[model samples]
Target: MKFNESLFDNEQTRKEFLQTTSALLISLSALSLLHCSEEAPQKPSKNLNWITTKPEKRPVMNVAYSPTRILLKNGIIIDGSGKPPFTGDVMINGSTIEIITPKQINFKGTTIDCTDKIIAPGFIDAHSHLDWILPLDGHPELKNPFMEQGITTTVTGNCGYGVAGFMPKSKYLAFIKNIGKGFFSGDSSTQKDKFVQKLAVSLTSMQQYLSYCRQHGIPMNMANLAGHGTTRMSLRGYESKPLDKDEMKTMLYHLEQAMDEGAYGVSFGLQYEPGIFATNDEIAEIAKLVKKKDKIVTCHMKAYSALSGTYPLKPFGTPHNIIAINEMIDIAKQTDIRLQLSHLIFVGTKTWKTCPQALSIIDKAIDSGLDVQFDTYAYHCGTSVINVFFPSSFLAQTPQIYEDKVALLKLRAQLELIVALLGFGYNDIQIINANNPELAKFNGK
Candidate 1:
């Protein structure tokens, strides 16, 4: 049909045209519009004559500044608050932002011309794991990769793995050493050795660890959480049962101390050992204290299993992720603790599509006056030690199981179960690394 093309002049007309078109013609029209849209406005050159009459001369200012103030002139300032960006000059006195104004202000200080630059606060990585990064060789400035992405603050000690607050007990240390000996191909002896030697003498508590991080001149600001797994280990060793009365007391005491020493909150890796074994009563005990102190409880809920759809063994019941979220919300309901759901996810084809419903559940809890928050990783996959998927008892016996044929068989059976549950064949699982030469063949398998 012959058409008046000017009907596409405005968005309303465009929509009408889209509705009247055949599918094949609509596709062609979309391609045509896409091609037309690819022409972007050309950026003006930095040395454009409108801004200057002559070629720019080399800057003559000294590379040093004696004044404790800095003036950033003529830039688009987006102050990190949700406010819209605007052109302004920002003045900093010492380390604090003293002023942001569109009008001229007289100031005797270093001036930086930010003609086309954007001035905004550094980004914050709300979930981070820096335990390994902090101990890496040569003390390379922290977060090189993250820095490239403009992140300047990191909240570490996430997912129940932290570097400090609990002493590396002799028995735990031996297990670590055994893992280093290739029982678990992922452990690095050198990395563990470095962490041990650096903190062995001076680091005893969360306060000490924070102090150590401060003293080390780490490039970015760091906030930490006291991990539930480490706290359980400190008090109950590698046991996978509920904490007894005295043991509970000790755990509570340490958590209180860590919060007082500047921990932002507490985190739990419920899918991992010891944390998975904590009873509802035990969790409530800790949540109560965190609520009392007005801190947060960040939990990686106990909903996930070795296989995506399988339920965790009882005491930690499961129908799915919804139950896990409800368990977390219940803590906030019972104790009024501020809750932060760490890495919230609904995996597997059966459950993955229910993310919106899961979120609605959280929203319903929030509507009922609970303090709830959540954060998630940006990527599609995650990394962890393979032992993380095993039962707590098996985890406790990892060192011995490596050499015991019966234990090895049991482990094999457990792995088979995981493979079946997750619907993974042998080729689906690839060892990240197997440092030992004898096991190198398994690395890419």
Candidate 2:
């Protein structure tokens, strides 16, 4: 059986097709950085031409301005208002939806006959890392996966980390090269220094990262949240402890600075360090800062299984998944800060039964006036560093745990439990991205 090739003729249909299928073709991180920085290496001739045909006063992100209009006519519209699908015309004035009507629109500078097409509000990738691709100096592309799927905007700084505008010189360059090209191995060793020195300019602060795009141009509108992992790592470097009084003060100061610089909110990677090191009390204190600023806090919880936990210990207690959910809810209740739950995955086959209970918890919280919401993946699996699979407490041992006889026995028990919880064996896992070039051969194997 074959799909009709002509489905590509419709712009909207084609966008959806490209968005869903691109991953089958290449790694997901193949996002294109289309900024027109004259310094893009290897090819000095390409550029990104931006249009400000309709600009607004104090435009979001301070992007360039101009007055413009577009009318999408005769389309099936899902207005996102809980109404049934209807045939209508949608008008846009710059980035705003100027009007929507059942009849033909009037005074359109650009009109598209979206006949037999699905016209809806632009989808937002609420958990995204598009900002990470923005600073990449080379290996640019014409479009990103989100944009191809008709996504107009994306939120980045997810899973408790993001590329900040104010990254230190070494961290900034290290991040760029690591994400762009996998780190240089034996054969590629000579290329590392060359890559970093050639592109020495690192984004300096939240303000600078945004301004860089405003000046260079970005295809989709983006909002970044300050990463709790990054902020804590900057001061503490994964020591497995909460911030002290003065350290907490410094953390608050940095958060305020980021908020003033245009961060949409803050996010936590509770499963990942140094997020795992943070206590509920510590997290609540940080949330209060967000509350004062009227911003949000998005958290990737400590565990995803109903009974599975890092340990039968503090920070991550038994029934870890439920404990993680309650932690965020508790923060919302205490600080009154808007809370966003990331992914909300239930790992391990046995844990899925707890879904109703999990949702019930969130439902009770929202019904009681606590501002809470969540997002999840369309599919079951995800990509991450292989080490993310283990408990942080176990991983934080002085000498890494792989070789010791007793440690290995203990680790085997942990692995056996993890395997039992998933029900699916190891075959389900696939390697997509690897930092070590030697391991690159195993990708997609």
Candidate 3:
């Protein structure tokens, strides 16, 4: 056909136009695909990639091996006994404290002159969950942060999340298998099945991790608490059900085993799943076991609010937060077991003002000769697995309105900072396992 000059383009020009048109079409198609993909529902990955291929090994860092001994000159020592601070020169040989003298000691090793600084036996975090939530490889840095905060020793894996070495192999395998299934399943039934499977696996895995720690010299000394929720989940499925006599027996046996394995005590996160389902009688039974072993019973009490109506049970009634605390108190009173009420501030809600009242009760119990100790964190608001938001009380009652403005503001700022830094918007940033290489890799960048 006799075409216009414009239509009768050269072969090269025609090819170029065709290529450009194709490229434009492909780009448009890709944009559409991207939009659709964004809108599409997410499916569980068939292949669970939670376990990273490259296992995390400790990074190489500078370690100073002293030729002889080190002397810390003119330092104030707080011996962690809540005693008076003393000023003196302390000499250290290897890991042992050699001597504390008013006069300086001649030593060949490194000398840290802490004239103005407070020299204390590292700070002890009596109750912390650093083991699970903290990045494994970042442990050194994480530990440094704690050290910077003057915390030398941290009691991790509390609230039924025992440390690595405490869990057994059979339980570990079961937990892994169950978690694997959960990673693939979608239906409620599958989820239920996976939950049961995972509970068993977790219990066994915890045992294995504990054993591993024993085999290798533990980097830092850790005291564990047998998680009541994990034990109950292992015995009973994820569905809320009463534990049978046999299951209770199994639970007690596991608790005893954990105690034998050098666990400090038993802990319960009664506010969380599985724990919420646990009855007072069930907890009492566990308390009895702990008492028999002369160990402590630490509980994360359910509700800590003035809105008593929110909880179906009345204040201090059955299943009430106060009731749970009282139950542990009763156990201590009856059996004389040490009882530690964990994180009083976070759970206290607006009752922060009323914490003194609660403490008074504990102090009274102590005065009456019942062993009881309670802990409060430096920060007012607390962080947990469920959510990252500040305590409802903090949001509900502003410092301008509340009587405790300074405390509330300090807590609020800390919570805000943590939320901002951690990108609390990202839901997937959960700390699953200690050996979770994905999080531990790249210096936790």
User: TM-scores of the models, in the given order?
Assistant: 0.70, 0.74, 0.61
Give every collision pair in model 1.
Answer: none
| lDDT value, residue 189 of candidate 1 | 47
**Residue 271 displacement in candidate 2 (angstroms):** 0.8
Candidate order by lDDT, highest to lowest?
2, 1, 3
Tell me the tens digit of each residue's lDDT in model 1 across 389-425.
Answer: 4555665664554445555445445545544443332
1-445 per-residue lDDT for model 3 (tens digits)? 1112332233325344323222222111111100113355577553423222111321222224466677786666666676555555677877898776544455556888886555677667788765432323233543566667776556765665443322244333344333333222212343443233333345354455456445643345566677776666555434456788987887788888877776777888766555666777888888889988988888776654432222342333332344446666776777777788887642322333454666677878989998788887653334443211234333234323234545434543544443343222222222322122222331212
Query: Model 1: how far is 186 from its true place, Å?
Result: 6.8
Model 3: worst 10 consecutive residues (lDDT sum): 26-35
- Tens digit of lDDT per residue, candidate 2, span 1-445? 2223432333334334333222222232211111113453575432312211111211121112224877776676777787766666777777798777665555526778876577888888898766655443442352466677888888888877755523355343444434333222222433443223333244545776677768767677888898877766656566776678987887777767888899998989887767777888888988999999999999988877644435452323346678789878988999999999998776655566668889999999999999999998665566544445556766566334333446544644665565555443244445564433444565564
lDDT for 129 in candidate 2 is 68
Where does candidate 2 stray beyond 4 Å?
Answer: 1-71, 91-99, 105-111, 137-143, 165-204, 307-309, 313-318, 398-403
Query: Looking at model 1, which ten-residue stretch has the lowest summed lDDT?
Result: 26-35
- Candidate 3 Cα errors over 4 Å, as ranges: 1-66, 81-83, 106-109, 133-142, 163-207, 214-218, 308-310, 313-321, 346-349, 387-445
The whole-model lDDT of each prediction reads: 0.61, 0.63, 0.52
